[model samples]
Target: MRRKARRRRRRRMRRRRRRRRMRRSRMRRKRRRRRMRRKRRRRRLNWRLEKRRRMRSRWQQRKMMRIMKRWRRKRRRRLRKRRRRISMMRRRGEDNEEWENEEEEEKNEEEA
Candidate 1:
């Protein structure tokens, strides 16, 4: 009977140790899940930030394109007027060296 009791005590001790190990493993799993959830949230926030940055950059590019188009139209109109003036000066049989220089400069600017 004493031997049986000793065996039972040993079995009970082993069961308690097993239960403790199980609890520790469960706690570790919970901690890992929490850490993964935090990482996912951070990734989601970063994705949103990146999307916003791209949208802003695209908007800026569109704005710059519109400004460039407007500038091009204004330059063409000015060049047309200068050409008309140069033609009129030529018809009047006037020395147009200054106008010719200006026209050459405008052409160079357009080439650039």
Candidate 2:
């Protein structure tokens, strides 16, 4: 009877050890899987962020180009108006020396 009892106790201890080891291994696997999932999620978010940044940059570039073209058109219109005014003044027999000086000034400004 004593030997039987001792054998039973040994068997129970071995079973408990096996269960504990299995639980630990399962916990380790769960932790690894969770970490992998987090990494994948972060990578996906990073890709989205980069894509948005690229789109935003492209939009800004297009906006700047549009603004610059509008400004150039306005400048051309103003220059054309100035030329019309000078031509009318010339036909009216006004002193054209002032207009010649203005043209020189405009040329210097454009060169700069």
Candidate 2 structure quality by residue, lDDT tens digits, 6-73: 99999999999999999999999999999999999998879745555565577776776677689889
Q: Which regions in candidate 1 have their CA more than 4 angstroms from the true location?
A: 1-56
Q: TM-score per candidate, in order?
A: 0.46, 0.44
lDDT digits (tens) for residues 7-81 of candidate 1:
999999999999999999999999999999999999887974555556557777677667778999999999888
Runs of candidate 2 exceeding 4 Å displacement: 1-56
**How big is the RMSD of model 1?**
18.0
